[model samples]
Structure formats: C-alpha cells, structure tokens
Target: MAKSKNFLLLISLLAFFPLCFSSKTIGGYLYPQFYDHSCPKAQEIVKSIVAKAVAKEARMAASLLRLHFHDCFVKGCDASVLLDGSGSIITEKISNPNRNSARGFEVLDEIKDALEKECPHTVSCADILTLAARHSTVLTGGPSWEVPLGRRDSRGASLSGSNNDIPAPNNTFETILTKFKRQGLNIVDLVALSGSHTIGNARCTSFRQRLYNQTGNGRPDYTIDQSFAAQLRRRCPRSGGDQNLFFLDFVSPTKFDNSYFKNLLAYKGLLNSDQVLLTKNQQAMELVKQYAENQELFFVQFAKSMIKMGNISPLTGSRGEIRKNCRKINS
Candidate 1:
C-alpha cells in the first residue's frame, strides 16, 4: 500500500515537472504525450511514412530533416514553410535557399493524408514535420529523442523570413552564427545543429563561389583539399551546372555520423560555412574537434539542440489552427 502511494506521487511529479521530460514551454506548453490519448497512432504513422520515403530515396531523410530546420528558423516550427502562395500568403518555396532545393513536400502531403484518414485534424502539420525530422535522423543512422508536439499551422507564409533568416552555404561564420542567434540559438546550438549537414546534399551553385572566385580572385579557395577541389570542379565547372548535386560530406554522406566533423578537420568540408566552424572561432573549432573525436557527444548535443530549435516561439493554446490540409489555411 505504501509502495502504491509512492508510485502515484512519482507519477504526479512527472505530470507536473516539465523539465524532467524536457518539455518546457516558451509561448505555450508542448509535451511528448500531447497526442498519446487523442491520436495514439500519430507518431507510429509519421515514422512508418518517413521510413518508407527514406527507403525509397535515401536522400529523402535529409530533405525531411531540412524541412523541419527551415520551418523552425522562420516562424517557429509552425509549418509555415508548407503553405503554398494563396490569398495573402507568399510562398517561401521560391526563396533563394529553397528554390530548386527543399524537396519532400509531396512526402509531407502523403503523411498528412494518412493522418487525416486515421484521426482527422487531431494532429498539426507542425507536429508532423517535427516528428518526421526526428524519425529521419533515426532512419539515417542518427540519434532519436522525444519530440514535444502540439505546434500549430501558420495562416501566412514569410517569403522574406525564409530568404533572410536561413543561412546560406557560403555565409561567413559570424553571419551564420548571427542568423542562429536571431532565432534564439546559441553558439553550441549553431555548431551542433549545423551537424545536420552530415546526411544531406548541396547544389553546385551553393558552393561554386569557393571553387572559382572565393574573394573575387581567379583561383579556387586554398582552404579546400586540392584533389577534392579538382573532383568537384570536374562536375561543377566555372559556369553552368548550378543545380548539380554534391554530397555535403563526401565520406558517409547518407549516414548521420561524425564524418562531417572529420571532413572539416581535413579541410574537405563541402561548404565555406562548414569549414569556417574550424577557422573562424576558437570555441567552435574546439566543438568540431570534440564531435569529430566523440560521436556520442555529437549525438547528445545534436538531440538537445534540435529540441531547443523546435521550441522557438511556438503558436499554442489559441494562437494558430491545425489545418485539415498542410498547404492551405482553413476558411
């Protein structure tokens, strides 16, 4: 009888203690159990769809991961990135960082359709993106964490925020750090979150400036590995092939691991922003070395930073609506 009473007290503590579960609120409460009773199969459905998509195309995992990042950085993980231009909304898909990039919207539509069939407006598109991102990491050989759900869909999209807020591949280290800080992320979060590049692809256009004229000079950036630069140039060229695909990490590109940090130590990081983590600041450089030396540390920090990033200014309580369709606002 005494043990039963203690168990009930422990349960009560968990029910009230947000930090114990890492479900602290910013603008509103978002907890992992938000849909446990309402839509018990919500997470299962997201994982199954994300796994199928990733199995179909290994790159799909990376694309879905990026979708969550792009969404959160702009209007706080509200699924505003999913909105198509209609009425007063301006589409973010055409933004510089997203144009010809940011694939996997059709995959999201399929997930939403499945959820609607099962639960019918019980889950938010924002939650779907967040859950899909965590699943993507796991499917791609990365760590998993409990996603705090209950985020809502935005009624409008931000084209300017998408363009200005998302850091470019060639952005200076300070510029990238500044952009992350604007989103309430710190230096550690910036370095850890940037590790998402471990499993993605980048366009030739995104890093071409370094290959040809890094500082308006005729030579390639000396910071890059010579043989690697030659290989990149064979496909990238000086002009054209802007849409050509290149792995962000040449070694283990599709697997989320410490290879990205190792590539930086070797001066083979695919993007200027990547290498700058080593060159630009002493602290970030130490972080790169630490992650390169310890995959477990990177995984832990990456999960924590992802949770922090997902918590940015969420619309909860009564602010936004859970759209029946992810792409349009409800009338």
Candidate 2:
C-alpha cells in the first residue's frame, strides 16, 4: 500500500511539474494563456487593431514586425524601444538603427489605447509588441505562432544596446551571427529570422556600399547580379537618395515567403547582410538554399526562432511595471 501511494505521488508530481514550468521552458514566467483570465479579449483586441492597420497600409505589417525584433534585441523585449526620451530615459528610438527608420509606433499606440480601455493596466507594452509581431506575420501571409505573453515594460531604455545589439544591414556574416548568439540565438535562428526581410523595405543608404565602392575598391559588389545592381543603382544613386525605399525582396515585396532566400541564391539579396547568408558561410548558405527550395521548412523554423527570440531575458513576474501608457513608465 505504501509503495503504491508513493508511485501515485511521484506520477502526480511529474504531471504537475510541466504545468508549473512549461512557461519556463520557452521564457521565464511567460505563457500563452497568461491573459486568459486577466483579459480574455487581449489577443482578440490586438489582432483586430493590427488587421485594420495592415489593411490600411500593407507595409505596416513589416513595420510592426520590425518593431518587435528591434525591441527584443535591445533590453530583451521590455518595450524600451517604445519609450520616448524624457529626463533619464535615453530612448532607443533615437539610436542609429532606429532614427528615421523604425516606425509603427502609432499602430502600437492604437492597440494599447484599446487594451487600456478594456482591461486598464492589464497588458504590458512588451506583450503588445510580441502579439503585434505575430499578427503582422500572419497578416502578411507568413507562419503563425502562439506568442508567449506576461512580459512587462521597463522603466528605462538602453540607447547603446539598441545601437550596438540590433544587427546592422552592412554587418558581416560573422558579426551578425555573433550578435544573435549573444542573445542565446544560434546560426539557424539567425538565418530563419533574416527571412523576415522577405516582406519589408530597405533604404538605399543600407546597401549603397554594396552598389558602389564595395570594399572601398570603387566597384559594385560582384556577388550582386550585375544587371540587378545596375537597376538598383539607377534609383539608389551614388550620392543622394539615402532614404529611397526598395523592396527587400523585389520578387514578392509585400508577401511573406521564401523569396528572400531565393533572392540570395541568385545574389539579388538587397542588403549585404541578406546576401552574406549565401556568400559568407557554408552552414548559412546551406540553410538559405534549403529554405529557398522548401518554404514550409523555412516557415516552421522561422516560427520556432521567433519564439526563441521573444524569450530573450524578458522582464517578467513583478520585476517590471504594467505601464498605463506604452510611451511612458508609471510615475
């Protein structure tokens, strides 16, 4: 009788262990059903607002998704990127990577305003950003993943982290992979997440070096298809048009798919970072080719990588506050 009781107790403990630590497996103190009782309509509200925004402007999907990536890379998705500069807050928005580039703040504000009215200080801006990113992906015909919630907003922003952590368009393959690895992400995650470029736009300034004077030799990067480079040069120019918008994946600019990988296969990738996946590393090149040929494989890895990225050192439990307004911390 004692042995049977002990066995039953052990089984009960085993069953309860997963329920207790399942969230910990992905992210500390975060779970998909976090707002199930606190705010039953949290996900619904975010989805509806994001849908409306993307419908109004298709590019908004990528912008919103980029916001989450930028936020997570800096300060571990604490919504520091959303904070405005005021007093002690340096504001990640003004960092080198974000200035004149990062957008979709208004769309996040719209979601926050609706969420605030519905549940007061229930949802964190960090969580809002995560949900918006997932919705943006689905809206743009990309893979869908259940976002783990319960992240809280930080009272401070890291300007240096924003500028230094987020991978630059011109970063070498090793540098970019190093940055990703610093956040507990691997080469597979780096390649999969780079796929996000499939639906976004890059400014001419980002790839101008590749078009002219690559390696300071005053010659265009030969890796880029010469004819394609000429077409880019026509609009990108040598001196001006720094902000001229070009689809990252010209093949299906607004659609989220493996065309970005396919572009790299043909050396038509818009940014050096995108092209380096094929040119700079053997492992990354193999992954790019695989993704280009089997989009379903790309989609699966992208979703998993995104979830892993979102888990990077989140401020959870009681460590951070639930800001009444995403733009400012609670006074």
Candidate 3:
C-alpha cells in the first residue's frame, strides 16, 4: 500500500511538470528545456535584462552577441572569457582580440544577479551567455532560435586560446578559414557568422592597416572604394586616434541584415577580413554573393550556424561548476 502511494505521488508530480523533470540528462548533449523545471524563468530573466541593456544602448545587442562568439571561440563557450585573473587562472580579457574589443560584461553581471535572486545557482553563466546572445539577436531584428542549455562555467581561462583561436580583423582569408576549421566550422559557417559585422562598431586600430600600407608597399588597399577610404582616413589617420570608432555596417549599423555582405560586394567592408571573402577565395565569394542577394537565405544559415557554434565542446554532465560569480571561479 505504501509503494502504491509513492508511485502515485511520482506520477502526479511528473504530470504537473512534464518537461521540467525530464529535460536535464547526464550525457554530453544539451537541450533547450534543460532549465524548464530547474529554473523555469531562466530564459525570461536573461531576455529581459538583455532587452533592457540594449534599449539603454543600442549597440549593447551587438556587444552581447559578440560576447558569446568570443567565449565560444576560446575554451568552448564555458564562460572562460568571464574569468578574471586569479592564482593560476589567467584571464582571457587581456588577450589580443579582446583587449579593447570585447564589451558587455556588466550587462551579463546584471543578468547574473537577477537570476541568482530568482533561481540561485541552478542556472550556469555559460548558458546565460548563449541565451543572452540569442535574445540580443532577436532584439536587433535578427533570427531567433532555441539555444541549447547545460553549459557550465570553466574553473580556469585560456589566454593563449583567446589570442590564437579568435581571428584578427587583418588575418588572411586562409588563416581565418583555418581558425574556423579548428572549431569544427566550415566555410558556410564562417561567412554566415561574419555577417554579425552587420550590427557592430570596429575600432580604427583594427582596420587602419587596410587604409594605408595594406601590403607594405606604402599604398592603400586598392580593393577598398576610394571614397570610403577617404572617409575612414579622416577619422582613423596614420598616427593618432587608434581608438576611434567606425560602424562596421554604415547602412544599418544597429540592424541585423545582409548589408554587410553588400558592403563587401561594393569594396566598402570595414575590415580586411570582411572584404577578403570577395577577393581571396572563389567559394567564399560565392557564399558572400548568395547572402548579399538573399536576406532570407542569410538569416536561415546564420541561425543554423549560431546553433552549431554554440554546441562546440560545451561542458556538461558535471564537467564544470556553476559559477556563483561570472568573473571569478568558485572558491
């Protein structure tokens, strides 16, 4: 009679929370419903904070989206990018690609604080990043997709991975492709992901080399439209103002769209890495043209590629800990 009562209780609980109890698994794969029961409001909390942050600063959406990319590239979206230097753990923030480029840490902290009040340590910081990126994209009129959860925070960071794995704005097309391949991504993924440039700003220092002495011949890169080059020069210059900001996509800087690929076609792409898709390789150029010509196609592939990128070597099944503070590993 006692066994029958216990079995009845279990069935009633499962009936009331069908998704919550069954979503989290022990294996490596993640699911969108991982936090359905564990923290039912996890996704909502992240999206609300991201939306509020983006509303305060239109560029916050892009910055938050880029944060996920940066985190994934180094140490597999384990929130390694969030860790500050402590003991043996060297922070990735000071690395080359992240030195002056990465932003949106404060916004993440705000989200983390809110989540802690609601669900405590049930949600992981890495999952918050992935969810924030998706919400940021949607807030900026980009495609929305289900972000798989279950990623845990890393106990240590990789400064070397940040420097070597994330491609620089001036890297050669072959080098950039090699970096993506290292992440198990292909050319299509690379081109689709680069479309993220459609919505952000780039520092003058990141692309100043293309405006002057691109090939060490003391001449500007001929591939860049001369008028655009002149505009960039007025702000970038040769010596000072290395930190001057330029819109990556001047047409719709805050909107997510195919104008970046179109800019590449017009030789007005802000980064050498952006323009090389057109000039350096046939396959890459074809992909760029397709995306530029078809916004729906680009959006579809971008959503798919984002899921692929987010799935790269995530920590699951007790591999890592849920960080209490994003910037510091648990003591």
Candidate 4:
C-alpha cells in the first residue's frame, strides 16, 4: 500500500509540475533575461557610439563589436561574458577567458569615451556592448541580429554566477544541445551560429581535443575530416604547438563567410564542438551544405541565432544596474 501510494504521488507530482520548474539545470548555464522595453532608442544611441568608435579606431571596431556578440551569444547579452566568465566552468571542463583579452578593454575604452559624450550616464556600457555586437556583425559583412536595447547593467558580477553560466567550448553535441535548449535555443541554432567560428581566433588550449583525440587519426565515425584534422593537429601538435592558429578560414581567416562550415564539412573545424555539427544530426549536415553554398542562408540563420542567443541570461525588469564602464560595474 505504501509503494502504491508513493507511485501515485510521484505521478501526481510529475503531472502537476512544469518541466522547467523541475530543476535549475537549464538556468545555471544561461545569462539573466532582462526585457529591453527601451531597446530602439538605446539601439540608436549605441549605433552612434559604434560610428564614433569606428571614426577613431576603424580597424578595431569590428573586433570590439564581435567581442560583445560573443559574450551575449555564449551566455545571453548579460554582459557576464564581458567579465571573468563569472567563473562559469563545468566539471572537467576547461575555462576560456576569451573576454579577458586586453584587446577587448582597449576597444571598450574607445567606446566609453564616445558614449559618455553623447548619452552620458543615460546609457549603460552593458547596453553599448550589446548594440556594438550587432553593429559589429554588420560591419563584419554578416547580417545584423536586431538588438533590443535598454538592458540595465548587472549590479553585481558574481564570478561565481558566471562560472556556472557559460557553455563549454569543448563540449559534446549532447552537452551543447542541453546547454542551448536551456536558453530556449535549439541544436539548429547552435550549429548555425557556430559557423561564426569560421572567422574567429582561438588558442590551441581550447581545441586540442580534436587534434590529440584518437578518432581524429582518420577513422570512420570520427567527428570530422582528415585534412582539417591534420591541420589542427599540426598546430597543437604532440610536438611543440603554435598558438596563433586561427579557427576561421584557413584561406581567409578574417572574412565572415561560410568557410567555417565549409571547413567543418571538410573536417577542418578548429574546435571539437564545431566538428560535432557534422555528426550532430542530418539536419545540421544540411545546414552546413546550405550555408556553404548560400551565403544569404547563413546570414539569415545567423541573425536569428544571435537574437536567440542574446535573449539567454538577460537582466529584464530592474534585475541589474547600468554601469558607467563595461569593464566594471558602477558603484
């Protein structure tokens, strides 16, 4: 009778509860979701900031812009990625301090000078990072994901909070899928936006797996292609490795085109997460083909993916503060 009663209770609980309420698994990895009710005006002000930054440091605007997008995409536009990953690390997972690039701070200062002049404290540097991310995509010759504005700055950046938030770059397809689904994004978006990897730079420490892993020796059921495999292995070799290897185009590293996907199709994608696109699903395979052949297809999907990615871990409705500098929160 007790067993029967317990079974009934278990069923009742499962039936009555919402799935998300079941656990914080999805959330512990996403950025806060803040509603940007005031995104348009904020976007315009941000656009002006980009223009100013471009006027001063034309060569670097695209990179700074990419920085913000990268942060938002990884853990929503929470600006947490702008910090020390908020200390978001998975068990046995390596931490990537991509945001810690001094290059990011260098461009951020230029943007601060511009925003302070036009909007002053009226605009938060957090919003500036979000807007700058969108503009940077456009500047990079990719589609602009429409950014909703007015995300107030986070009051406290818990390196602890961040540590549990961002996804691991070296994760498996299942791991990446679970992480993305938590943020309301799906596998298709994951594979598509990951094509952005085609143009970015990374340290071998981030992607040494595909290089040193056993399957990459060119076996069936191996994650990626051999030529691409050999290339990454060469960079982060069992022998002494070189750090300047770009994950983007072996042909044209800086151009934001389909080469990343093209490389993945060839098994040349730099990261293990990247090679998973080919093995993740037949649908992802189709996307790789479409994106490689049709630039517009890649653009449209990338824009949608960016918007979805940004919505993760947001700071909606008085959740966070608007800081004077993006690097640090306002007291």
Candidate 5:
C-alpha cells in the first residue's frame, strides 16, 4: 500500500506541475524545448544563410529570428514577415534594413536543412527563429541565454498579417510605442530595439512623413542624421518611391550593438521614431547610454525582450492554424 501511494503521489505531481509540463506542450504540439545548448550546428546554418544573401550582406539569419520574435510577440510569430501577397513568400523582394528578417524562406531553408540533416525535422521553424535570435544576439555581443525549444511553426502567413502587425520604420513614436507596450516591453526595450533601426534604411514611403510631414508628426524630432535627410531629399526628390532602404548605421549593417544608441546621441538616428528616444522617452535615452557603456547589459536585456516577444499568444493548441503558405495562409 505504501509503494502504491508513493507512485500515485509522483504521478499527481507530474500531472499538476504546470511549469514543468506546460512549456513542454506549448499550444498542444510540443516545442520550445532545450534540445541544443549554444547550438553550434544552428549557428553554422545561420552563418551559411547570411553568407549567401546580398540583401543580408554583413547580416545574420539570426536577425530573421529576431524579426520572427518581433512579429510573433506583437500578435504571434506567424512568420508574417516572410509572407507575400498570397501569403507564401515574397521571394523576389526580401529583408530590407527595416525588414531585417525579410530573407524569410532563404534563412528558413538554411536552418531547416541543417536541422533536418543533423537532427531531422525534430525542431520547428518557429523554434528555429527563437533559437537563432538567441544565438545571433550572442554573436553580436548580446546575451547568450538558453531558449526553450520545441516551438512548432505556424503553417500560415499573408500580406495582411505582415502589414497589420509589423511596425513600420516611420510610424509615430506613439504608434510603435503602443505596439511594443502591447508585447509587455518597456520604453527602454522599445528604444533599444528601435535602435536596431539606426542600422537599417526606410522606404520613401516609410519616411515620407519625416521629410514632408515634419513638425508635430509625433516622431522623435529630427530623428535621422541631417546629412542622411538631405541625401534622401535629393534622391527621393519629394516624388517618393526612389528613397530605398539604406543602412542607418553604415558601419556594420548586420551586427547588433550600441552603435545605434551612439548614433542617436549624435543626432545620427535614422527614423523619426528612432530620434524620438531622446524627447519621447528620456528613460529610454538613459538606457541607450548604459547599453553604449556596457555590452553585457544590452545582451541580457535584449534576450529577455526577445523571450518576452516570442512566447506571446501563439496560435498553439488550436487558437490559430499552421499556415501552409505564409502569405495566404488565412485566405
């Protein structure tokens, strides 16, 4: 009788322990598990993908992971950034400075190839993004924490979802702030992540307001460098469309570091929103100073931000569908 009671108690504990088991079966499929630590294989695959892409030149597939977290955290990581008009992939036009992870399928292919070969289809693309971000951030001198693996991929993607959730480069600080806040991120994290924008470019469409709308746009006043603005004005010529996405931090387009914050302090911030850090959120400004001073501090916080962004209300346990074609998964 004693032995049976002990066995029953063990079973009860397993059944009731939500933290231990709940994460095991995320959204019912089972993922976000720790299959690999500092996954060397995963890093290699990320390197190969970054190596081949001109769009992602000097970039990391891990950025795609960051993007996946960005999008998903906003409203679930659907790989929406990877979607096309039809919800598949915009294979022709992918990953710009703003849409860093736009290399969607290409990066996914690389990670998938490696995982499939070494470990088979044991890991999902969803988790791939999760881990890749963690890995890449570490390489870029950010945090190197262990992410729970086993996050299953959503078989869905579409232009609408991408257009809907992802924050644009030139949106008002209020808009983007709300978006970040919705994900449980504070202003400091928002400023740091937006600082990533300091490294990327914006379409004429994304930045038109700054150039034309100007004052009271609610953007961080004079966010981009004046030289950059002049150059944009010359190229775009107020006619629009020609103002392509360029690197805000021309130094190292792909790496994540304090250069963004450094640029902002120098009035070299890219988007109006990027510039907004100074006046719109002074606390965020101080953090920029801190991150600029210490690399480890940035990494630790960035990882936590990434994690907060990843485990959002995913379409797990039947809440959302596994998108077949990321672009048109819903329609």
Candidate 6:
C-alpha cells in the first residue's frame, strides 16, 4: 500500500510540473499543459512539422522564429500577421517590414493543417505560432523553455500597427528601444532578443545605406570595417540587388549562438539595427560584450526574454477565436 501511494504521488507531481511556468493574463492563466487533455499530441505535431521544415531549409528555422516575433509585436501573438486581406481585413504581410521579407507561411499552414486534422478547433493558430518559434530556436541549437499555451487568434490584421510597431533596420537605437518598450519589453530584452540574428539572413537593401551612404553624405559609414564594407558593396551595390541575401552572423550563421554579439564587437553585424546594439547605447554595448564573452549567459537570458516576449498581451478566456484557417478569421 505504501509503495503504491508513493508511486501515485510521484506521478501526480510530475504531471503538475508544467503548471509551474504558467503565465497569468487578464482573462486566465496560460499553462504548458493547456492541451495535455484536449489535444495530447498538439506539441508533438507542431514539433514534427517544424523539424521537417527546418531540416529541408535551415533558414526556415529563423523565418519561423521571426514570424512569432513579428506576430507578437503587432497584436500580441494573436496570429494577426498570418491573416490575408479580404473585405474589411487588411493584410499585414504587405507592410514595409514584412513585404519582400517575412517567410515560412507555408510551413505554418502545414503545421496548422496537421493540427486541425488531429483535433478540430481545439488548438489555436496563435499557440501553433508560439510553439513553432520555440521549436525553431531549439532546432537551430538554441535553448528552449516551456511556452505557456491557450492563446487565441485575432479576428483581424493590423497593417498600420504592423508597419509602425515592428522595428526597422535603419532605426536609431533610441527608436528601437522605444518600440520594444511600447511592447512592454526592456533594454535587456532588446539586447537578448536581438541575439536571434545569430541564425538568420538579411537583405542587401536592409543595410546598403551603411555601406554606401550611411547618413546621405555619399560616403561609407566609417563604423563598419573598410574591407568588410568593400565586400558587402560588391554584392549590395549602389543601385540594385535589393533582395540579395547575406548572413546576419557571418560566423556560424546557421547556428544559434553568441557569434552575433561577437560579430557586432568586430563590426561585422549585417544590419544597421544589429550594429547599433553596440555602438548607439553604452548599456546595450555592455550587454553585447557580455554575450560575446559568455555564450551560456546569453542562452539563459535568451530563453527568459523569449518567454517574456511571448507573453505580451495574449488573447485568452473568451477573448479571441480559434480560426479554422490561419489565413482568415472564421466566417
């Protein structure tokens, strides 16, 4: 009898472990076990699809991760970024920050489809996006954390909010920090979240100004190494190749690591938004140096900051609906 009681107690404790990381929102709590009963295989389905996608195209990991960031920044991870324009809806996909960029939608659709078939109207697209981001990070050799689930998809997309809210590559450090602050993130979150650049690519157009005319002075930005600038200019050029791709972290570009911070220290950061983390603010510079020196510390903070960012203004309880199609609200 004693042995049986002890075994049951241990099982109960194990089952309750995920609830420890639950995040509280205005409507209700979001716990990791949100679908343990309703959709027992929800996370497994998402992870499998994300793994297949990332295995096929390593860049897909970063693109999926970026989708979560872009989604949360605009409307709090409500899948607003996934919506297409129809009637009253205006797609955020065509916004300045996302147009010609922001990929991995088909991968998301694949995950959502599998999820819907497994459990109809049970898992939310918002939750799928959140899980995909976490899976993508882990797939690219980054840390993982328990993502609180139970989020719902928004009924509409925000084009204006998408354009103005998402940080632009050319924005000054202050502007970027302010944008993050508006999302309830802080300086530490800014530096840590920016570390996501460790595993992504940037367009030539995103940083051409720094290579050719950083301040419209018709001269290269001296902040960048002359040799590196010359190499970038060859591909980026003064006129065309706007869509040319460059690794955000030239060293270990496909791996999620602190090399991005080290690149910033060496002035090799691919985007102006990236280099400014070190040059434009003393505090952010210190963070860059710390992360460059300590990969473990960067990983720990990256996981925490990601969870914090994921918790921004989620729709819970009776707030939002679980959309049948990720691209449109339920009719």
Could you tell me every candidate's TM-score relative to the true structure?
0.92, 0.92, 0.91, 0.72, 0.70, 0.92
- Candidate 4 residues lying further than 4 Å off, grouped into runs, are 1-66, 73-76, 83-103, 214-221, 239-242
Count of residue pairs whose backbone atoms collide, per candidate: 0, 0, 0, 22, 31, 1
Q: What is the lDDT of residue 238 in candidate 5?
A: 58
lDDT of 1 by residue, 90-137 (tens): 899889878889889999999999999999988999999999999999
- Judge candidate 2 against the unseen true structure and give its global Cα lDDT, from 0 to 1: 0.88
* lDDT value, residue 279 of candidate 1: 90
What TM-score does prediction 2 earn? 0.92
Candidate with the larger TM-score of 4 and 6: 6
User: Over the full model, what C-alpha lDDT does candidate 4 score relative to the true structure?
Assistant: 0.58
The per-residue C-alpha lDDT of model 1 at residue 105 equals 95
Q: Is candidate 5 or candidate 6 better by lDDT?
A: 6
Candidate 5: tens digits of C-alpha lDDT, residues 206-304: 556666645564554355566767766765655756546556665566666667777767766656666777656668778878877875556555555
TM-score: model 3 vs. ground truth = 0.91
Candidates' lDDT values, in order? Answer: 0.87, 0.88, 0.87, 0.58, 0.55, 0.88
Cα deviation at 289, candidate 2, in Å, is: 0.6
Q: Write model 4 residue lDDT over 65-103, tens digit each, in one string.
A: 555644554445656544432333231112344433324
- Pairs of residues clashing in candidate 3: none
lDDT of 2 by residue, 1-331 (tens): 5564354335434433443365453335777889999999999999999999999999999999999999999879789999999997889999999999999999999999999999999999999999999999988988776677789889999999998999999888899999999998999999999999999898999999988866566665778998899999999998999999999999999999999999999999999999999999999999999999998778777877888888788888778899998999899
Error (Å) of candidate 3 at residue 261 is 0.8
Better candidate by lDDT, 3 or 6: 6
Q: Which ten residues in a row are the worst by lDDT in model 2?
A: 11-20
